[model samples]
Target chain A: MLYLIGLGLGDEKDVTLKGLEVIRSCARVYLEAYTSILTVRKETLEEFYGRELILADRETVEQEADEILRDAAVSDVALLVVGDPFGATTHSDLVLRAAKAGIQHHVIHNASIMTAVGCCGLQLYNFGETVSIVFWTDMWKPESFYDKIRRNRLSGMHTLCLLDIKVKEQSIENLMKGKKVFEPPRYMTVNQAVDQLLEIVQNRRELGEELALTENTICVGLARVGASDQKISAGTLQQLSSVDFGGPLHSLAISGCMHPLELDMLKLFAVEPSTFEQINIEDSSTYLS
Target chain B: MLYLIGLGLGDEKDVTLKGLEVIRSCARVYLEAYTSILTVRKETLEEFYGRELILADRETVEQEADEILRDAAVSDVALLVVGDPFGATTHSDLVLRAAKAGIQHHVIHNASIMTAVGCCGLQLYNFGETVSIVFWTDMWKPESFYDKIRRNRLSGMHTLCLLDIKVKEQSIENLMKGKKVFEPPRYMTVNQAVDQLLEIVQNRRELGEELALTENTICVGLARVGASDQKISAGTLQQLSSVDFGGPLHSLAISGCMHPLELDMLKLFAVEPSTFEQINIEDSSTYLS
Candidate 1:
């Protein structure tokens, strides 16, 4: 049997009791680390679970999945992933491989960031669509994600912007040069992502595209979610771009039409809610303020 | 100081080590119950954490804010949320209240469903906008969310559909009649949400509005996410509509355009990879088959 477990977000202790039990019973445990990272380290998890965990990077999972699935053919193998097993499409492939081989598998679920965005005091029901913002490279600055966020906001839905994280990713030059060079791990901070978003907004503005994203747009920044010392701050997009959230692993939310209550809650997190009123007078004074 | 901690999507053990340390040190620990529920009960968590926990319902948190915040004003009080502290926005109000009352507070993070959807083999970066699918009532079946999903799908961005959960809510008739009757808890399952989505799709089809959703469109169903018994099944929106994922808590993903690699991963989860053959077909098919 192949046991696919969700480690929940954060550290080793975040694994479900049932998942931990499965891990303990499994002959081999592999932690798929590329898709997401927990706030805790591998050593901390190993100490608590009392099992040696092999760190499975993107290459291990994507390029060498056969080895991970090799033992499952004979014995119970557990592949632990942060968040729900199906939260990332990567594990779905593992499930598929297990299915193709006719190996019975079980999935252990856990909280992922998708449903957890509600903690920012926005109504879960009111959110429109979530989008991801990637690191803008000099050669590849794709604004496609921006288009989606723009549409979501136009329809009055809150947009949760997932920041990018590059783990063990090779630079294009390295691949072309065949140098096997790897860049340092980079987790997009909420501040940096906001800066890129602002740049895109400016680009669109120059092109006369009537985009909703602006410097003073209400935005929420979250850092080190599911870890101790998680930080959440609400401010204008401009404020967020400058405000240091102080950590790796960050996310940003550009709220759409908010409820009166949501606006009130966001007010406390604002760096300059007073100045923000100029851009959103009706929402600021008429509804929430 | 008040520490709002997310327990994540699973049982008691899902709490991070950081969160646990805080819980052990805090004077009061309250679990927010209305927004979401953990697979393990309070007793289960108490047994694991070796600390008693107070389950705070919406009433306790919202109505009795004064009481919950009283101790926080003086010392450390930990408010535990099921997912990430900001996952549900419910805590934002609490956080705001604490801020206004001159109470210092901190947030402990946990993996939330927001970022966890990446596990489903979907490209986290490919997702366009996240939308919420609410439990439809006989009187209040709003289809606005459909528009948002349609918009996202049109733009070839995956949509993360957050299912609804209603707890401690009053019956409409009972409330209107001034009776103290309560309704049973209602968690929007994957099947029911899909059924409604299909109905809305059919409605749009009749109205001559080109809908991005169709019966054969690819969708990923998630249930009991972040829990030990989590299940993920990939199929057409039609096939998914008939699947009874079982138990409380469910989410759905309507995939849009896929990158070559993403399409490859998604095929691994599909009911029939051949039916999914159209997925970036130009890419090498030899390895996929």
Candidate 2:
């Protein structure tokens, strides 16, 4: 039997009671380490589960998943992910492989940034296709995410911009040199994401393109969600670019039309509640049922 | 402090370890009963948490919410939700009120249907704005959901249709007479949702409107998600309209463009895998990171 468990977005204790029980019973436990990270250390999770964990990076999950599923048919094998087991398509790919290999599998669902973004006051239902905001290199700056956000905005839908996290990634120099050296893990903060978004706005302006998002557009920045010190701040894209939301795993929401209820909830986390009063929030109450 | 904990969509054991601990220590534990439901009885959760659970229906949560948070400033109070705490705006309303009253609050994130829909093989990021499909009445048949799905299809994004569950709702006639009687809880099954969807498609055809979804369009029906007996089936809208997915809490997903990987995963749950071979699945490989 194979159990894909979600540890959720918080510390070790965020694992559901059922997930914990299933993990304890599993013969081999592999923690999917690359996609997302929990606030606690790997050792903390190891101590809580009372099991030595094998870290499964992108290479292990993508290239050597068969090894993880080898004894699953006869023994309990568990793969723990930081968020919901199915949050990333890679895990679904593994499930497809498992099904083809005739290994019975189960997924234990838990919260991911996709839904946990609701903690910042934007309703999950209001969000459109979630877009990933990747860190840009001088040579490889991409702005396709802006187009997605624009599409979502056109439909009056909020866009959840999932910030990038580069773990065990090789630099172009290292990759070409055939060296095994890896860069330190890097997590894009909300400020960095906002900067990239604003940069796109500038580029679009230079190209004489109509903008769906501008520096004045309302945006919410969230960091360390579901944690005790989790921070959420709502402001304009320009304002959020300077606010420091300390820590990793930050996410930003580029809101479209706002429901009065959403506007009310967001005011509680606003950079300046009074400033929101000055901003015209087109009511989307008609859309609410 | 008020602990707004999410009991992930399953039985009582789906509660996170942190949530269970906070719930056990809470002076008063109120389960938000109106929005959604878990598979087990309230007694089951009470016994698991070793605390008496007060069922907070709509009236209690909306009208007497102050009662739930009145003592939170001095004692630990928990308002347990069936899914993630912020899955509904009602919970966010409670949080806003808590903040206004100077009460500290915490949220424990858990899987909601929004993200758990990924189990059907469609990636979460590919999903556009989530839409609620209610049980249509003779006088209140609304086709707005179809428009939302159409917009999603235009953007090549999947649409997650959250089936409505009516609990402790009063009939319009009863309300007109000021009756205290309540109707029996009714949940919208996948079949029922498809019937309404198909009805809309027929209506659009009659009106000579552009159709974004049709009888032959691929859709996935999910029932009892995250449960031991969870069932998933993939078929066309017409095929799924008759496919019985036993019991409540069913969700439907309308496919837009399918990634080759998504197509493979959907085949595992396909009504007829051979049927998918006949469909031209436009590859969405380029959209994936």
Candidate 3:
């Protein structure tokens, strides 16, 4: 059997009891390392699970899937993923391939940022479609996610913006040169995401489109969710762009319509409680009791 | 400190190692019994955890939250919730109150239906706003969810309909008589939800409104996700309504535009592969390569 286990958002201890049991019994365990990074080191997880893990990069998983599934028909083989197994479409594709090969497989679900964003005092049911914000280059700035946020805002729903993380990425120059060298990993900060969002808002305003957010628009910044030192801060886009949310794995949420109760809960994380109150008054219709 | 731990959607062993550690050291542990249920009985969980659990129904958690948060300031107190701790808004409110009361708290996130629905081969990012479908009564037959599903369908996004479950509910007759008796627990089946949805579609058709879904619309029915006996089936709404999902806690998904890859994945669970192929050809635009 091939087991796709989720090593949730935190340290090694976040694995479910069932997942741990499966990992212990597995003959070979592979950890998909490119999609997301765990807070703890690989060594820490190895120590906790008492087994050596084979690091499977994107090329290995995408090109050598047959090798990964070879012995699964007779013995247990586990592919551990950060967050939920199906959080990424590639994992689903892997499962589909497993099915085609007649290999038995099971998924052990765990927390992903898709649901952990609720820790910022936002209701999960109230969130509309989630969008990802990729790192912008000098010539390649994408504004498609802005339109999604607008649609969600018009519908009075929150939007979760997953910040970008570039892992094992090759430089364009190196790609042209066919070099196998990889650049250092880069994680997008909340400030960078907000700056890109504001840039989109500016371009849209220039095109005479009504905007969903502004400098004073309330937003929440979350860093290292599901970890002990997790930090959540709520404030306007302008205020958040200046605050330093230490470390990687930051997420931002653009508030749409809010219930009074939601506002009350969010106020606890406000950079300046008085600013949050003033914004609530300026746009009273945005919040309902 | 107050610890809000999630018991993932499975039997007793689904809790994370982190959550189990917290529960083991906590002075008092209370399980919220109203929101959702674990597959195993309370006794099973008790045996696995080696500790008796205090069942906190709606009243205890909502009205007497202070009681649950009482000794957390001095000693560890845990409130166990099925699925992720913040899957419901009331839990967020409880966390907010804990913050206001100067109590330090932590949330141990776990698998939630919001992400676990991916087990049905539907991509998580393709899902739009999720809606809840309640059991329709003669007087309170709500059709608001139909509108949400229509909007999602129009946007070419899948919609996950969370079937409502009634626990510890008192009937109007009993309430009127001032009787303390409670009604038997009721969980909405995929069939019941489809019936109500079709009723709304019929009403909309009579009103000359364009509809996004019909009896022929494709849907997926999932039962007891994350459990060993978890089942997933895909077919038209008419076909799925006849499927015996077995037991409580069923969730339905209305398919919106599918990627050819998604269709391929979903085909593994099709009620009839030929019917699925015919539907794909008839509504080719609903899927993109």
Looking at model 3, residue A254 earns an lDDT score of 84
Query: Which has the better DockQ: candidate 1, or candidate 3?
Result: 3
In candidate 1, position B200 carries an lDDT of: 92
TM-score for candidate 3: 0.97
lDDT of 1 by residue, B202-238 (tens): 9989999866677777788987776667877787777
For residues A1-289, could you state the per-residue lDDT of candidate 2 as single tens digits?
Answer: 8899999998988999999999888899999998889889899999998888999999998999899999788999999998898874448778988998899889899988788888877788778888898999989999999999998887788998889999998889999999999999999999999999888899899999977888778889999888877899998888998998988889899888778788788888899777577666432321232
Per-prediction DockQ scores?
A: 0.34, 0.74, 0.76
lDDT of 1 by residue, A105-158 (tens): 776656666655566666665665567788888889999878877876776767
Q: Candidate 3: how close is chain B to the reference, as a TM-score? A: 0.97
RMSD of 2: 2.8
Residues B41-159, model 3: lDDT tens digits: 88899899999899999899989999999978899999999888886434876787788899988889998888888877888888889999988898998889998999999989999
Best by DockQ: 3
DockQ for the candidate 3 complex? 0.76
Candidates' C-alpha lDDT: 0.75, 0.86, 0.86
